[model samples]
Target: MKINRNFDNLVPSYLFAEIASRTAAYVKAHPDNRLIRMGIGDVTLPLPPIAVEALRRGADELGVKETFKGYPEYEGYDFVREAVAGYYRSFGVTVAADEVFISDGAKSDTGNIGDIFGADNTVLVTDPVYPVYVDANIMAGRKIVYAPCLKENDFLAMPDKSLSPDMIYLCSPNNPTGAAYSAEQLRAWVDYANEHDAVILYDAAYEAFITDGSPRSIFAIEGARTCAIEFCSLSKTAGFTGTRCGYTVIPKELVRDGHSLRDLWYRRQATKFNGVSYPVQCAAAAVFSEEGLRQVHENLAYYQENARVISAALDEMGIYYTGGKNSPYIWLECPNGLGSWEFFDLLLNEAQVVGTPGEGFGAQGEGYLRLTSFNSRENTVEAVQRIKKLLSSSV
Candidate 1:
């Protein structure tokens, strides 16, 4: 038998390895240039005090024989699910506690959710997308298709009248490019999905980072429950990156061909996965606490400031960009018509600031760039300054 052939065509290793090689070469040649990375979208903050206290208390409970939690229920611990359900309510969305499947992060849930779907489904994604969605569908052997999301569209991806797909992926306050869909836009897509009996895998990992009046949940749109599964994470919401906890909401009302996706997902979880650790889950639960909400929103405000800084810099340079007001990423048009990688090299070599090239995201990302606000405030300011200098010199 042949080894899984899909592995042979995978492209990330080559792409990221090339990024590493180029970054390494730059560092070697310019050792004195201090690089401030705004790539990879990693969290720089520590766990909040509330989460920390809960984590410590949870560990202490585990130390007692009576409170030790062994193998977690595949669906997840009730307390964590209840807390997540409550968290949903805060946004005016209703998700049942039993419908919540706690996992490590949104990325894992986004990729692994493909295990339950049929291989023959047509998958639709934004042109310049988060990459995980398309790659996951490809690995699952689905017929993948794309929709262009460019400057004219404000980089908000939507459905086309020309196609109907069985599965769709959407990231609001999107990852690499940081574009968010308006409620009206999402409603239209929901309408399309409902018309076609398709499933929309809604990713809201960066929803907590949105500052504008944009809806934070897909459920904000009417009729989403009939055709949507939303994945949310505490990683961006509450600095739980290393802490490892996220949840997927499967509505019981989501039925197709007399089959319940909620039940299928329950079976899938029970067969292949054990739940997240109790202490870490307890920490995630704490993220819903009153104190935790205040602290985390403060952190998000700080990150929003970083986005403000980057977007302001872009404006001063007269560069066109999307996604600063609502999300922590600034998608910019590459000046001088430089190719994405060439622009990446120019920024790396001249400015000593690292940002993700838009092409790495997808084909429609060919002439753009993505810089994140996940860096420290100091670094964000410094990087913007460096960008100004580089653009001034180049132009």
Candidate 2:
């Protein structure tokens, strides 16, 4: 039997995997090096106390016969969905509880959602995007197109009316570039999708990090409900990276080819998926509670401070960059005209620090690098100083 030969077209190794391999080799050779890793967006903070307590309560409930749960609903529990709905309302966006589907995380939903659409549909994604968006579509053997997110546009790629794609992927406060789109800019994309009869897959995983007045949810834009499906995660928001819980919102009004996209997603999940753990959903629901929000924001504030420190150092170095204002990432141009991987190596060897090479994201990411604020405050401070000294020495 023949395999899905499309797999043959993918790159030999994933971006992060290659980074790990190189770092591993370095550590093996230099045993005394104290490496400070600022790569990979994984959070280093502990889960919020409120969520942890909720998790314990939910788990305790399972011990008694009355509260013992068998299998969970594919679309998640009513309480969790209601909490998510209330969260939308707080931000002045209305969302019905019935429309939310609880999942493992945004990463899973984003990669798996493509299963509902036709294989023949064309996919469009921004260049220098999170690799999952592009790689997943490649596995489906779909014809993929790239919208260049160049330096001139501040890394925000706009819709090109000339190209017609059946599906589009957009991440605000974008992954590698850390640039977000304004409401007026997003309106253009929503209108374009409606006109082209195309569906927009919007990733709002980093929405909570937004400090400015940018729209936190695509539903904040008018006409979006008719064309967009939003995926959000607690991984970055509430430090649920290891906890594994998030939600996907599909509007009932989003009908394509005369089929309710929401209904289609429901059917897809019910058939192939078992749903998130009851304890995790309970914890996720608490994330929207008053106390829960306060605790999570405390952790977020710490990361924001780390971002501020890094940004200040870059300012001193006179580096060209974006983000670290409303985002937890700093996307900077490699110093002294160094290429992406070249800078990655320089930081690793000279500064004993690590960051993602922008080239790993896509072609447009060349000569760029991405740094995260997910590490401890002390580590963040030290890493920036190390970077500063290394760059200064070269000059």
Candidate 3:
């Protein structure tokens, strides 16, 4: 039996794994260094109290036969789905409860969503994109096209009718760059998708981190319901990284080739997947509760302040960068003409701080670096001071 050799075409190592490997090697060689990792975008905050309580209550229900649940509904429980739908409504976007499909995480859904489409379809993805979008399509052996997200457009890729791609992957409050699209910018893509019969896979994983006026959901844009499938995670939103719960919205209006995409996704999940655990769904639902929202926002403000510390440093140093305002990531151009990996090594060796090299994202990401605000306030402040010292001494 032959395995899918398409995997052979992937990069030798995942971006984060390589980072971990290098960091590990450094610590082993120089045991004296105290590394403050501002690399991987994992959340450092604990889960909100409301969610924790919900999890405890849900788990306790399993102890009693009357309340015990064997398996969740394939699309998620009505209560949880309603909570998700209610969340959209809060942001001025209307999403039906039935449109939500509970999943382990947005990462899983984003990669697995490609299953419903034929391998022959062409995929359009922004440069310096989240790697999953590119790698998933690569694994499927689909034709992949890159839309250049250059500095001129502020790293927000607009629709180009000339490309005619079948599937478009858009991540706002983008992962590597942390750039988000405006409602008007998103409307252009929505209209373009409807015009070309293409489907947009919109990743709103960082939506909760948005403080600016950018649209939180693609559904806020007119015509998006006809052509967009939105994926969101409680990972960044409610610090559910460890718990692992997310949801995907496939609108009933999105029918392609005489098949409802929602129904297609439902069938796909039911076949290859069991639903998320009841306890986890209960915890996720709490993320939408009044108290849950307050606590999550408090945590978000903590991270946002961390972002301010980092962004303020970049500003004082006269470094060119994007994000860090409405995003937890600060994407900056490397100083002194250093390459991506070069900057990474310099920071690790000199300042003992860790950051993600942008080259891991795409070709356009060369000479750039990504710093996350997911660390503690003290660490964030110290990291900035260290970075400042490094740059000052270099000059």
The RMSD of every model to the true structure, in order and in angstroms, is 1.3, 0.7, 0.7
Q: Candidate 1's C-alpha lDDT?
A: 0.87
What is residue 316's positional error in candidate 3, in angstroms?
0.1
Alpha-carbon lDDT of model 2: 0.94
Cα TM-score of candidate 3? 0.99
Q: What is candidate 2's lDDT per residue for 1-395, written digit by digit as tens?
A: 99998889788899999999989989998999999999999999999998999999999999889999979999999999999999999999999999999999999999999989999999999999999998898899999999999989999999997899999999997897889999999999999999999999999999998988999999999999999999999999999999999999999999999899999999999998999999999999999999999999999999999999999999999999998987789999998999999999999988889999999999999999999999999999999999998988999
What tens-digit string does per-residue lDDT give for candidate 1 at 1-395? 77767755567464456777888888898888899987667788788889999999989999999988798888888988999899889988888998899998898989988888888889998888877887777777788889888888888877898998998999998866788888899999999999999999999998987766788999888999999999999988888888888999999989977889989888888888888888888888888988889989988888889999999889988999998888878889999999888899888988988878889888889989888888999999999999999889988
Clashing pairs in 1: none
Candidate 2 runs further than 4 Å off: none
What TM-score would each prediction reach against the true structure?
Answer: 0.97, 0.99, 0.99
TM-score of 2: 0.99
The residue pairs that clash in candidate 2, if any, are none
What is the C-alpha local distance difference test score of each model? 0.87, 0.94, 0.94
Over 4 Å off, model 1: 12-17
